[model samples]
Target: MVFARYLTPAAECGGLGLQCLGVGWQQVSRIQFDGRVIDCYGLMMIVRGTGWFVWGDLPRQRVPVQAPALFVVFPGVYHAYQPDAGGWSERWVLFNGPSAHTHEVLGTLDRDAPVMVLQGPLDGMERVFESLFEAADSSSPHRDVVTSSLVHRLLAELLAVKATTDVARVVRHFDEQATGPLSIGEHARRLGMDTPTLRREMFRATGTTPKDYILRTRLSMAQRLLLTTDRTVAEIARCVGYSDAAYFTRLFSRRVGQAPSHFRKVGRPRGRDG
Candidate 1:
């Protein structure tokens, strides 16, 4: 059996607003859990297994058989199980803390319904498992935040594989134009679609107007440059697609709640200030 653990601290719990207690992984056989009911609110992904789950007083329910089956168990739920006579192998993780939101995000599925099962075996299962494990074992600042972020990423990958799509083209386009100072009309012409049609399709596909998305992206780039580079505000403005420094300052101040110079001086370390 292989075992790993990751521990998170309190200070770094921000953004998604959850404090991760810890994450752990274990690969074990039936003998390890013979006649034991593990209790916790976390997740379990069966890399290899043929087993059933037994709740108190309930007849055993065969785990919906699948290679790479992922299960989510809520806190306090009664659970006990063993692999079929042939025996089984599986991987699992246990996490807890006020910031844990695994159960909440996956609430649509019955706790025992088996959240997802990859159609085929997946590579990198160990990396995912170990990442969470290391996060649980460490006490570095913001470990919990980082662990929670990784958890979301893992779930996203699973979902993406399960529902493959051609939206890659749209995503690529968004990435390319996000920080560019291209107008919606120019973007529509470049994509060979009329403005209204392009707007409709972009909104339908990405849920945001191209102009708004581009503005936000440019703002983000401007912020990064402000924090990490020594470029003048005017130069950074042009780099992020704002030809007019004053206009850029207005936009930045409106969105970030501070003047560009003040933001740089107060928000970033002096050495990092550009």
Candidate 2:
């Protein structure tokens, strides 16, 4: 069994969106766990053997598990797992951040389907786990940042494999209509899908709800326009489907951590002729 350890990152790490609290890989035998709750999120990848799991408020229904699978542990949610006849080999990481919470709300980090089956060769993911372990063990001042990035990388890898064709269509539609004053409900109707199904499919494919996805697309277009054109903030807001510049500014500042005007001024390179 590999050694496991937890960490307390520097306070500044929290500002980076996600913080790695602990990480390790282990092999277990004859382990029977009842249930437990934690304050942070956890992702456990089962590499070998089989297990069973259940989570909810109470009177939970158990889920059967197998190798090459992953399960999520939600904060404040009661969950339990145990190895089948044979034990399981697993890699696990604990993390929490505003970004993580946003994903949960957006339906990307699903609570209903906490455990997921991973496909394809896992060598790539194992390599990342190795890097995570090394970074977590490092004493460098930037260790937290490095480890956090690796965690993001792992999630990206998972998404890359999990996204389906239906999700691709949804993303394409969102991108095409990002600048229009269209509601997600309308978009769902256009696709002949109900709002909830669209949401579920979108979460399965992109780890975001339709509403969040369109907002991101709009803001992305707004950023491009801000950098490439001389449009006023109000004009840019309207271009992105926001009639209220003041409200847009509030959202931009909250998400991007700067006012639109400040972002344009600072993000652009100064011409040498000036």
Candidate 3:
């Protein structure tokens, strides 16, 4: 299956200094981009299968990659990549702006070494890509602004996963399981550590307690559902791990400073149904 969306930024989107030119995902027997130096940045995530990549001029290096790997396509760089005979599935985003250069300067994206083996539970990263694809839809309101924010978020999440530390694993675990029943004690035990050690590690890495992080993660999902889906508040509440609708409302109101219904009304695209 192959699907892609290309976006043209509105005038107002330029001030943000970031624009997502396109978003796409494909399942293919083979694919290649070679011979021409492109003028925009591309982020590609290999969802399945193995591949070989060759980049640079004259003295290029050929790299073998497995599934769940990520690679960057720098503007004007000589690069080419293709899956093995078995093929692979990939999700990619095309973007360009001053912000991309800033990330390069900050060491968030290294042009010299463009690919990294992604580690830990990838569910969270996949969700971000899915959200980016959805937000780039032409029918979605504020396409440019939303896609730009999602791109930034994608980078941050990528960095966290690449850290490859115990805390990073813990965070990925929470990210994947936040909508289900969870307990700090159970998680710590699973990690072969005491609750205090887990707590300390989480605090040092994220500056937030595990409990609070879970709460924030759940609420973030709740907000996304509220804006993008037609599900009722009760359903969304349950979907995000709150069984009691009234209690969920109370917590959401306290933390988010607005009722879910009100937030949806203000945030949902015009003319969109329930």
Candidate 4:
């Protein structure tokens, strides 16, 4: 049997945030291929088969990649992956853009390490991938917005699989909380600590207090949404948890060095880079 689907994102999308360069599925039982270095990232998830993962000059590692496992290939990295006699079923997404560093900064992806054994079902990535496919296919008025949100969610989901740590936990909590509200004491209580203790520990670890950390997180998310979505300033302000659009606009302008509306249209201001 043969099954595969692919999509190339729109030009406006490439001009904005992380663009979904491509996506597809390969379900052949027997397979092998040598891939040369290129300027993008590719992820392959083994649905139901085993494979030998080979890299340049490295000893051929017999990777019996069980179902629901993912093998990642990053830009400028030469590699090869060949399924065993049993072959393998797989789905994948190829992506690149300025915002491609999300995974790296989050510490969830590594060039040296190319394999990721997933803990849950394999259809999740495919489902999100197909959402991207459909968005790119339809050329939705919100194509760039939809694609960016979907891709970001996809990467965040994959990153969630990595075991949590103090830093990761802190960052994750800050992200979730920063999206729609501001609550230090409440959040700290949920983390099982008093506000002062939480602030002290977070400061020791990240050089920033929980409040500052959450502010930076909110600003960063706002910047991303500004670049990506077609939403209005009031809408975005509320979405990021600010009921007062004027206040959100002023804060974003001061922190980002550009008004949210201007940033969305002109891309980071010239010579006013922050």
lDDT of 3 by residue, 38-67 (tens): 899988899899997777778986778888
lDDT by residue for model 4 over 116-224, one digit each (tens)?
Answer: 6666444556778778667756646776667677777777767755433334555667777776454788877665456775776577557888877776777777778
Top candidate (TM-score): 2
* Per-residue C-alpha lDDT of model 1 across residues 86-136, encoded as one tens digit per residue: 555565655454444543444322443434555533565557766767766
Candidate 1 vs candidate 3, lDDT winner: 3
Per-residue lDDT, model 4, residue 12, is: 70
Tens digit of per-residue lDDT, candidate 2, span 1-274: 6868788988988898889999999998857687899999998889999988899886785788898888889999999999887899999999988888776764446787777666655776788888999998888889899988888887766655445434666777788887787777898877546789789888877787888887777777877888999999999999999999999999887777678898798874232111
Off by over 4 Å in 1: 6-8, 11-15, 32-40, 55-60, 64-66, 85-87, 96-109, 124-126, 161-274
Which is the winner by lDDT between candidate 1 and candidate 2? 2
- Scored by Cα lDDT, where does model 2 land? 0.81
| Runs in model 3 lying further than 4 Å from the true structure | 31-33, 165-274
Looking at model 4, residue 121 earns an lDDT score of 44
- Give per-residue lDDT, candidate 2, residue 255: 71
- Candidate 1 residue 135 Cα shift, in angstroms, is 3.1
Model 4: lDDT to the true structure: 0.69
**Given candidate 4, what's the lDDT at residue 88?**
86
